[model samples]
Target: MSTTPTPTPIPTPTPTPSLTLTRPAPTDNPTKPLIILCDGTWCGRETNTRSNIYKLAELFGVRIGARIQSPDGVLYLEGVGLGSSFLDYIFNGITGQDIAQQCITIYEYLVHNYTYPTHEIWLFGLSRGAYLARAVAGMINNCGIVHPLRIAGTNEIDAPQTRLLCETVYNLYRSPYATNAPHAPQSLRFRQTKSWPLIGDEDPADRTAPRFHPPIRFMGLLDTVGSLGMPEYTGGVGLDWPVFYDQHVSTVVANVHHAVSLHDRLFVFQPCLVSRDHARHCRRDWERFGVTRQEWLPGCHYDLGRQRFRFLREFGGGWLESLLASRWFGFASKVIEPNHVLADLALRWMLLAIRAQSTTVNYEVVANIERVIEDVTESIRGRAREPGRTGDGDVYGHVLSYAPFGSLLLDVVRTLRGTRGKVSALYQLFFDLRDRLIPDDNAVVYDFYGFDEDIPGCVGDLARVSERRYPSKSYVKWRLRQ
Candidate 1:
């Protein structure tokens, strides 16, 4: 019997978001594919949280302290980052600074840490992470990724040669402004970080000039909310937040997969909204490659995203929440509010509630949540149809996931309208009622994700988002660009 070839060793790490070097998967094939997954804001790489990115990583058998049996030749590595914590997410989550950092960090980690002469590269992400993945693809397609060893004059920091070279690299990958944006189509920033006359986008096969550009096989994203310079969930805009997410798409990537959420409506959450205009631009970019698939799924932001933290994982799904998921509005409307005492009370109360529940999830309770949904959906629609309502084109259809509970909860505080407490009550009551609901077998399961195969929290392929949902009459918010 022939012996197995030795796995390739990774180079020294200079600065990476997070690098994982492991033995090749248990397979005889020669080509080992590297799959890098990025998590969204507040998506912890640690074991405590339930990030879909991690779930995908686990599927690839790329873990911190475990060996996995993967299909064929596969070596998994993930580049994770968004902000420091769930708090930084409140402000810096989608800033250009953060996106740029993630893009560069991931690129450096991959290009420097590993050399995949014969392996495939796949980029996967959700929410802001998706934006970064697409941005990375754009950079590679335009301003190719360079190896760390290729960064010249590292020994002499003050040298002009070193300064210019470092600035070029930094501006290309991490700068908020790209003065050469006109030449670079992937990123549309007009000041800096833009492409400067085929500087990095040289021929791929060429061995000279610190170059190694791997063709990304696929880009899979879930509800890519490239909010561009939207204000923070808590308050204020990022100093480095790019004014525009821009009209750039990587021309090199082979295929694109985007899972769109039809029902995500929370004001602060709305800024990250991926518009139909952006979708059209993406399609145009991927047109030559002929690999663009976009789908619309039901549920609120959490239903679409499935970002479960410690509190949700232990408690599981509720009438309003699947895996205790809530959008930025949940905290932005509460804990981050200017009120000092109330925020503390809310935090303590939430901790108490989470502590009260056992880690064991109750499926029966989740199954019965449909009753609550039906009640709330019908109730909200009835109120909206009262007078001068767009019966056929109500916003509810677009935000089916969150509108019901959000509307009903709003009714509870209609008496005390405009106060922070009123808004808090709306959000608070929704979660409270969700956790308390019991099962109702009489309720037929509603198909939120239009697929026959049930991938809970939707940790699956974007192509699986379904073809039937494409021509939906409900009018998902993706308007074609003029």
Candidate 2:
């Protein structure tokens, strides 16, 4: 002992193991992910009282499995004034103001009072809220440091980390600038930047970047009364986002008719300014990729949020779904694997939660979308019966023959499920979309009992009229039409 002379006691630092917890499975008593709602233009802690905000929360609460369906521990933040440091600097030109930090503070508050069996957090925002969500997400992921915001001189607190299922209203008024105005370069500056929180630069190996960007995706409605494509707004210019993100992300542009049309709207005409291409561009891109534009009808930005469509709100929004679902389950299958069953279920729950939460819906959008689906279905059915068809017997089969068309049709159906309303011009718009999708005259092969005749005169006429605007490109368009 004396020889050993107690070598100056070496203090062995105990390493902290990564934190993990067990909760009831979703089926038995699903743990709800924490729900945080960021405020819109002028929001505050009480935003949950607002119709839109409340609805989003309710829907999210209903979405978590069973245990958390009530969302008692859910925390709501206005995400207004000054919070996210980056946004505070960007919006208020003030440095070190972190709204995201405030978010973390609120989150920590819940942890103290609640069990926090699940780390998955569900974040909802509209317009300005979207920007706040983005900033908060970045801060949480980039810097483990969370800066909680003081609410109306409230006590200091810890913010919670959440999986965001945020939706931005791309309507004229909600955008950075009014839809009818001139395209501003500053509006899209952020989109052009390569760095963003969570979503990183495009991987050269992946080609979807130029279109989908990162976590942010564009969901537009169609209506001559509304703006088309991307509007040049002072803020929320997704075009400023990375061309692609290593984080697997995708975009869905449901073509709801007339309520929020993009057709000849100024934004639609100036695709270059907003980094957006016209329907022709989407069509052309899809054609090149052997896919087609998936056009749905009757729903606008708001309408899509109301209805419980798994594809638009969740399945397609895998970014949000995987984040929330895995938060509690700790299941890598849903987060990492493409087409994982749990992931799909998570998507369904998201849609259900959103639908359950949102009460506001454009009735007109619902009717219009339903009508469009009917029209397309009838249109395809009629085409299938032509005297000189030469392909598959079933209507779906013929549509699937053209992979692009099939994909487009599938998306259209998906949108219809989430939309409402019936604009008079939507049927015409469908024909227009169909025409843009199928440009070749001889390529319209309707194979009914090997007759191999031309497309029906009605479809053919629509195609011809719609073709010149969208000239035939040499791209090898896929023949699938879902």
Instruction: Using lDDT, give the best candidate's number.
Output: 1
Error of 2 at 143 (Å): 6.2
lDDT of 1 by residue, 212-255 (tens): 23356556676566544433323332122334343344444545
Candidate 1, residue 64: the lDDT equals 41
State, as a TM-score between 0 and 1, how close model 1 is to the true structure: 0.46
Those runs of model 2 whose alpha carbons end farther than 4 Å from true positions after fitting are 1-32, 43-51, 58-72, 79-119, 134-482
Q: Per-prediction TM-score, please?
A: 0.46, 0.27
Candidate lDDT scores, in order, read 0.40, 0.28
lDDT of 1 at 96: 34
Model 2: lowest-lDDT 10 consecutive positions: 253-262
lDDT of 1 at 317: 25
